[model samples]
Target: MKRRKYPKANKMMLVSLGIMTALSLPIQAEEEIFQLDETVVTATRTEQKVKETPASVEVITRKDIETMGAERVVTALKLALNLNLSEASMVGNQVSLRGMNTNQTLILIDGRRMAGEDAGSTANVYELDRVNINNVERIEIVRGPVSSLYGSEALGGVINIIMRKPEKPQSTIGLSTGSKQQNASYHLDLGKQGKWAWTFDTLFTDIQKQRRSETTNMYGPRQFYNISGTYDLAEGKNIDVFYERMSEHLKTTDYTDDGGREYFTNTRNSYGLTYRGRTTRGNYELRTYYNELEKNTDQLEGPGSYSDFDRANYKTWAIDGKNTMRLQDDHVLTFGGEYRTSEYRGTRLEDNGDAVSTVTEHGISKSISEKSVDYQAVYVQDEWKLSDKLLLIPSLRYDDSNRFEDSLSPKLGMTYHFADNFRLKTNFGKGFKAPSISELYMKMTRRPIPTRTVIVIGNPDLKPEKSTSYDISLEGEKGAAFGKLTYFDNDVTDLIGTETTRAGSVSTSKYVNIDKARIKGVELEAGRHLSNNFTVKTAYTFLDAKNAKTGEFLQDRAKNRYSVQLHYDDAQRTGISSILWYEWVRDYRYKDDEDKDTDYNYGTLNFTINKKWNERYSTYFGVDNILDKKIDELVLEGRLWRVGMNYTF
Candidate 1:
């Protein structure tokens, strides 16, 4: 028989907390909430218990994010067992589910799509950095096709970020600093102050990027802000308005032999207005929103000489309305329609050595190109309670767009309770994704020299990508333990990919349909409460992916990934909490330019501690990669430290 002893760090933390508890003000502690019986609103666009949903749904609350000491969406998403995190060429990080690319996974904020320069890449707008962590109430992840209600961009799954709704008056200010980053934020939540409730939040971050031991890509002074308010009109009726904005600038640290450097700037703005009404039989909502994004990048060949640059703008407008009704309390019927319009315009410099510093310096309209599309969609879904232990949901949607033919998507979901604490669920759905502006009508050319030129063009004849997806799961819960196992398969046809044609000193790359692809995977997740103060959780994912036409494996598609976490809380004592987490990844091998296979397996540990001094103050400390794990730019950058403090009044 043997017993493991606690680490010295744990004992030191407990002693420090005890001393603080005696010296600090008196306050009551609140237990952290984590269970499988919670309610979610994104699975079916309606409030339903997670355990009873027709599909697998995962949720990460605000408390979980704080406990992990995560400041970005990409970091927090690591906790989702069904998701795979990988590096993107442009954006630092992106996520995929069931081995599908991020473009197939729709990301929504408050149930609305965001506007950004897609540029035909899986990573869209950099929401990983723009989203204010302090303003997020919870994140809902539904794994499987949901195009029957969400239309395009749901071929793999859906991720919805829900904003906080204030019911009490409180304001908070926070500050944090790390070896490579610094952050500051303010949040104001005003409760029902004479029928007018509102919230305001802002965050500023500066991150110093690195390439091994060298300094570079340091995006600094990133600013973000959000403001919203609600006004009561009558019983069960209200009007809400919201506005958000983000801005940032980045420059490179390495310079070319010719004294050339890279620079870029980005800005985004979004606003919306919504009206909601509820009655004895049903609820209805009508809303409209506008989003705009601007981005520009350039390479400075020398002082005041801007070369190889482009300026782009994208805008989105949407109007939507939906109604949900209850019929005899057995069936919940929901119907919705939407009108959306998107436009993109961009211009690239024609001459690199012409000493042009700005896009408008030469009336760039001659080099500018534009594309736009309008979309109309309507959908209907019915959730039927067949009995106390059986549930059935059927939905259908029709979408029309100027760039693609009309398409119809249908879906079916069912859940059956076979035991007192166990449920079996299955889902089948068809999904659709229309080509983006860049993929459909892009025209750009680059001339590194007078004799050589490279061109990237679009294909107006490209067809829309479609997928047929299915998933089934078995879940159970008893007392303080719960577990879930799920299997998912997706078959996508007419996938859009690039093909290169070279002739002499000229090369052309065009977007085209690249046959079919198949991806399937298994996910296992389980958690248990060891005692009143301790909990443990583990998750694993296994994937099998292939290109149906060539039978080749998908690039960067990992075969095995897993994570483990152990948490402790002194909620009944000094209001302190701590967690130790570790994750490992392997089998995502790929061939390099030299035709050599590259495979590396690595794991790291993260530790964080949080202490609540009282109702109005709190502090936290954390360290990432305690073992000093490093993998160049693909993984961790050795060990990093962070400390934060917040005050509420």
Candidate 2:
């Protein structure tokens, strides 16, 4: 691995920080100040003001999304401080928060979980990308351990996407075209004040293939579709249903005349139903969901000779229920339970000189080509307002799985309002992730040639990975200026890895739990509204992540990262608004499969302008990665421009 210097970029970042800090100071002492009253529901399963929540949380409102001109959920997520996005050759993009692996973070839509792992124990972060940004009301991010409430995969934190509900009868249509993609969307609402209120939304997108160097499409063509509807049964009661589908086609070819070619196709379908209600004494919700994913690949040698065919299928079903009650004036109790099941099936066939034969099958046995697992969990939490200036929240959860040992997770948090506009908070939580079905039952063998054989086997005796996290923070707001500083540390044990063994000409690989890790970091966030038309926001993060046993730096974890944005609006007085954003990520170290290390850095600038024609129409234009910064290994395309219009009636 090699390291490069970027002194010019570093200087610019420092100057920008100084200017923002200076501008925020003058607005703090103004007599009339704007206060933020944003509310969020992911932190506690109940709605509460952002400032009153006991945990560290960040929110991206609907207005913010529109102002930023983000076309995908991943684009919006990257704006958050301390979060890292990586592009994988097969998985599209993977997201990591606070130096944790992608699998350690949990993703949710309307508080419902989605599938994370495949039959090969590989995490697919791109699953969240299927969501339509037009249907989103807002995004809430909680930046600490939440395993006590959500069960597994919460060691890093949680990202919850909330959908919009209509309050009046209206319809909206949107269309956009870009240098690399095209998009269209439609939404409608009817009978908002009646007992039979309903809302509908849909989106379609098409992305063209991107080339690398002179040839080879790094990213293939992709198409997506999503539909959702909600019906109101009565006051404080409703039922909602949603369905989404996507198809992708990819092709890659070698430059040589006798080179091989590969074609891949992927299709996914997901749907869910939710019922929720509220009463004088309590509130409750019930939800159920089903998801299916299929992948197919074909390989061809020179000209049109068949080489191989591979296919895989994954299915999941889940049901969950939750209830909240006000037991006393100072105590609010919440209870939840969930059941989930998943299955995986896969097969591979290779071509011989005379015929094609089955080469690999993934499952427990030949008779049972599909491997399945079931999981159950129950959790309870209490939010106690001990005093006017003090608050405490305690939570506990127990989980049972058919293939792993039973486990328990607990968390405790406290907040003290020491001053009129200031608060101190601290939290401690235990987190764990059970072994996936692929890590416990998958079996496969491959024979590339006549004398070489490769075998891969799962380890049913592997232990679950566990972590203990601690965080403390100081938050305050004075007039139009607000800021927060936080420090966090996490200790993990029994981390999973692969071990390889070789005997003569045969090679074998197996999964093992034999690693430990420790990660610590500091985060600082500050923002201010200078006036009715001008605003500034900034965030910075410093992380120290390493292997606990070997004392080596962790791979793919950046040491420094920051983001800054400047926004101006005329309050619709002038019918024009604009925003400028910049992000910097310091060089990070990563180890390749061949035992080589590399360091990389990226800096990008984005700007958007909006023009309002009237109350019923608006147009927007934006440029992404204006500086054209490139990372060859990440397959990032540079300098994209887009324009779009929205209509409402």
Candidate 3:
């Protein structure tokens, strides 16, 4: 027999943990060097203060959201972080974080995962307005690896949309109308100290149809309605819930009639609930969610008329738990777990006079499919202050599921404060994602040319995708000036995307696992208060992503992006504050375009002004794409403007 050695990631972690404990013997003090003041953070499993954490975090307050006129979460995120928003050739919106697919980026509403759409394998930002901003307190974003805290889909980073709580007993209403569209929202917040508290909000949006460059109808009218509320259970406990629905009606080109009857509709529904509690030792939370979607097209053709329809519905449920403790003088430990399951049902039908004589009959055939996935993970993290200015954070997680092979992920990071206003930080982590149900099982039927073709497949033996990510950030914060710069690199294996095959004259495609890819980028942001009445914010991002297996540039990664904002405020007199802003993005890739260098250079300038008549009311106006320049995308409109008001009593 021969002796063998195995790499001990856990042993290394324990050694670091022990050393941290030994060094903290003499540093225990009752006095807080940093005020443990309450600050909300959903970046971690626990709602901890931002200053006490060992990770880089950014918070977007509700006040800031209103000032920036952020009606959609994506717009709020775009203003907060330098992310790339790309349009899909087929149908949908794709957002990239740190040059990774939008699916790789995880988004949460009040700490629960937001479900993906059926139109494509992507999250729908189109329905963001359904989330009433009047009930949002703030948003937290962690721009780097968070899989050590969150299980999967947090490969690139995490975005948490935290809703507001009713801190007082009050009510408010608002209305607005503007170019091409308008919206109205109302809020009612009632609470009685620690016994019971509740907050309710309602929002409605009716957007006018849009036209193409040729003055022909391109996009149809859209309407949305939402109602949500939260109730406090008891001291250190609470329950929150919400419901949302959106609808779009369009006279589309695909549904044209000689008799002048046209029809097309898209609708979505989403709702969820969350319960939370905090103890002297740690904190705990639980959440559950559901979403549904349906789309239809109906019409009567000229002489040779035909009808078709497509429908899709999605459903999901999830549970997550986390806890944190100050185990020792120098070591803070965090532990948590998560589970999620999703199902999809869809169909496409056409009337060819086989079962129905006329094209006016409902043509949705009986095509039903179902898929489900289960994920369970447990993670533990330790934060050790090695010295007065040196700190180390190491974490490990085990993820097991019925869908793929189990995996163990390890992460290590350090932060060294060398100056009062400067610090150096670095982190490396391993992350993985279970195959999405959509990728594992999808069926399609096609009839082309002379004959018909049918394809049905599910890769039950598929493997989980994995990635290794590393990043370093330099940050500085002073009285009125602050700046941050981060550089990160990601190596992904077993990437999932569509693979196409040809059969006779028909070509069919399905999602499959591929070799590998690499994404690298740098992000910079700076802000300064020049004077008592003047302030400025600016940001820049440079990305270089490629397919390591093919040595080709990755699709849809912009090489350059920049944004600038100037603000002025007067606490006295007019009670008005205004901002002038501009943004520039250099073109990158589109899935439909064969040319790799389809570069585009475009910029936009916009302005917003908010005036408070008194403590009870405020009015504001905003105009986007001020020059009305054409920015082409598959599902997005050209340019638009909005005006609104807020009142409280």
Residue 232, candidate 3: Cα error in Å is: 5.3
Error of 1 at 127 (Å): 2.4
Q: What is model 2's C-alpha RMSD?
A: 4.3
Arranged by TM-score with the best first, the candidates are 2, 1, 3
Candidate 2 structure quality by residue, lDDT tens digits, 395-493: 999998987888899999898999998999999999987777667665656654448787667778888889999899998877778788899999999
Distance from true location, Cα of 343 in model 3, Å: 1.6
**lDDT (tens digit, per residue) of candidate 3 on 558-641:** 666667778877654448887887776664544443443444556678888888888888888878778866745333354667
Which stretches of model 2 miss by more than 4 angstroms? 7-31, 116-121, 191-194, 213-225, 232-235, 252-261, 348-368, 445-455, 502-507
Q: What is the TM-score of each candidate against the true structure?
A: 0.89, 0.90, 0.82
Residue-level lDDT for 76 in candidate 3: 56
RMSD of each: 7.9, 4.3, 10.9
The per-model lDDT (C-alpha) reads 0.78, 0.76, 0.65
* Candidates sorted on lDDT, descending: 1, 2, 3
Instruction: Report the C-alpha lDDT of model 1 over 1-649, residue by residue, as the tens digit.
Output: 1122324533433443343233223224423345447888887877899878897788998877776666667666767876866654335556576788778788899998888756556344365566777788889998888999999888888989888877689999989888656789999999888889999999998876655323344455788899999999999999999999988887664443246556778899999999999999989999999988897777565666655677778899999999999987789999999999988777632232123233453223326656788999999999999999999999999999998888899999999998997999999999988888788777678765458888878877888899999989988766666677789999999998889899999989888988699988888777666667887777777788888988877866667667677889876434888888886666665555455656556667888888888878888888878999776535457788888888999
Instruction: Point to the candidate with the largest lDDT.
Output: 1
